[model samples]
Target chain A: MKVLATQTKSERTQAAILAAAEALFAKNGYERTTLRDIAALARIDPAMIIRYFDSKDALFARVATFDLMLPDLRTVERSAIGTTLVRHFLRVWEGERGNSGLAILLRSAASNEHAAKKLRELFKSQVMPALKYAGADAYAAERAGLVASQLLGLALCRYVLKLPPAVTMSREFIVAEVGKTIQRYVAGDE
Target chain B: MKVLATQTKSERTQAAILAAAEALFAKNGYERTTLRDIAALARIDPAMIIRYFDSKDALFARVATFDLMLPDLRTVERSAIGTTLVRHFLRVWEGERGNSGLAILLRSAASNEHAAKKLRELFKSQVMPALKYAGADAYAAERAGLVASQLLGLALCRYVLKLPPAVTMSREFIVAEVGKTIQRYVAGDE
Candidate 1:
């Protein structure tokens, strides 16, 4: 019982550190944010962060681990795939799951070379697989690039840049409009 | 003749400073780069930068003055406006004009609040007016936001992140595919 209690407390500390790091990274970006800032927010010793994550780079990697959690597109109706994907992304970015990881990655990717590399890897690993799974056979790579351009663009404008129209746009409207673009990229003929 | 020689030499110095500032800002971003670095690259005294541009903020603003140079779209056949705009942007980004100003702005905007605000203003002043001129009536603002999302996303993926597929896709292909989306945003019905 004593060991179990200690493990649970450690887990809570890890979670708190991660949460605080995500908030700071998302707000101030990677280079500007320091481990001390995270430690102060998490109410822990700065050394505790290094103990938990080894380094700032490791901690940021943990914070930026984004799983698209894309639904099995094969199961989604063919005609609805575009709308479905757009809807899923909107949820990933703004829905209950919270977008701190994505926000941190994107905000950092702009100026930090390492973060930019990680984002490129995420695009290859997560986005490419989804497109292939949905039967994008021949030009799958190109189509994935097209879809990414629209989706990432929307996220940048709405979430990061806070462009008024993109921020204020109704979720349904975005789904319909951007959905059409995604559909063309995914399923339309060249 | 003596006054003209002095004036010409000052103008040449100013142009050299601006060019060097643009290259450094595009390469190192806003925060990480220092006036010392700019001075070193421009081969001038650090105080000369202050004398010419006043401050780093002012220097960056001068470096990021991107004129989209979008032609009046009202004259083009409605179907071709999207293609024309995309083609123009391709030139602006990768063609003869060189994209240093745009690259500097976009690279900095990701992490800098001031640059982000300038991007929003550019979107409003440059992109919106072009769309309005193209007859994007009721949803002009929304359409402009959508257009900015795609174009900026393309720039981020292809230029900043250097995602392979986006970077490798042919200029004609990008114009064709992204143009269709632009057409829908600018002229298509809801």
Candidate 2:
């Protein structure tokens, strides 16, 4: 019962702000959307956004706080790691998870300094560590960065912009083809 | 002399518009920017944008046009080719030639329908035939798309974001490592 009631009003308000921010940011982007826009969307006062996230950058970090997990990558056969990684990425990105908004952030993160810093921190904490432990350490961080480019690029083509051929391809086909390339990236004969 | 003299005021105006659009689009993006804004930056009337480019998307397509002259790629040794291609690309993207804008368009292209369409067209015309001719017809379009992603991702991380590690690494090291991966994406160890 204590765990059930662990939810606090402030936390709920914060979550509401994040949720509203995601929709607006996704619909628009970091530059166009304002604190007031987010507040109006969340049906909360603009000050609440400042209260929870401290700044627009912090709010963006929370909105972009997603993980790229490869389904239990620790124990898989070394040969299958690449395919597994690519397939799982396609599943999460193209399926109901719908990474269109995240894709926008990734594309914009380069020029926008705030987004860029958060992205670097995210790669260091979440991505680079997993890649390092995966025994890709020789070029793990760089390779991880490269792989991110590929995944984000695919999202750009298939999810965000939605090209005809890319959109038309079945998941299995994409996994098989792109999977082969990523296979070399993570655990194949490189 | 005739060509220079024959350049009409309208032609100059159109060139100005394209120039303005490229800079603004690179700095901001497709959605956030407006014709009024482009006109203001160009010191021209907003109506000029519509008159010249017909539409924002059309103007973007015009400004984002790219040409990839990958000559005699097949005959080159596979090992050296990777490094060469990487170096060439790094040069292309880093130099003030056209690639900074190219990088932005490629990353953000997947975020917009018109831009994405143009990307697909660019691949079909510029990249696909090259790969196909190089005996990579099995999945040339997809492979080209992936390559574009890796390149754009690196540009975003290294140039636009200026991630220290990525930026610190020499062009040769990046080309050598990333070239190996790109080698696999092209035709693989057949």
Predicted candidate 2 versus true structure: per-residue lDDT over A1-190, tens digit per residue: 7853797988778778989988987788777889999999888999888666656755775576667664666777777776777777776665575454455455446335556677777767766666555555477766676666566556655665565556666778767767766666666355
How high is the TM-score of chain B in model 1? 0.70
Q: Show where candidate 1 strays beyond 4 Å.
A: A1-34, A37-63, B1-34, B37-63
The TM-score of chain B in candidate 2 is: 0.63
lDDT of 1 by residue, A1-190 (tens): 7764677778989988999999998789777899999999999999899777756765796676678888888898888889999999999988695446687678667656767888889998889988886754688899999999999989989988888899989999999999999998998753
B75, model 2: CA deviation in Å? 4.2
DockQ of each: 0.62, 0.28
Model 1 CAPRI quality: medium
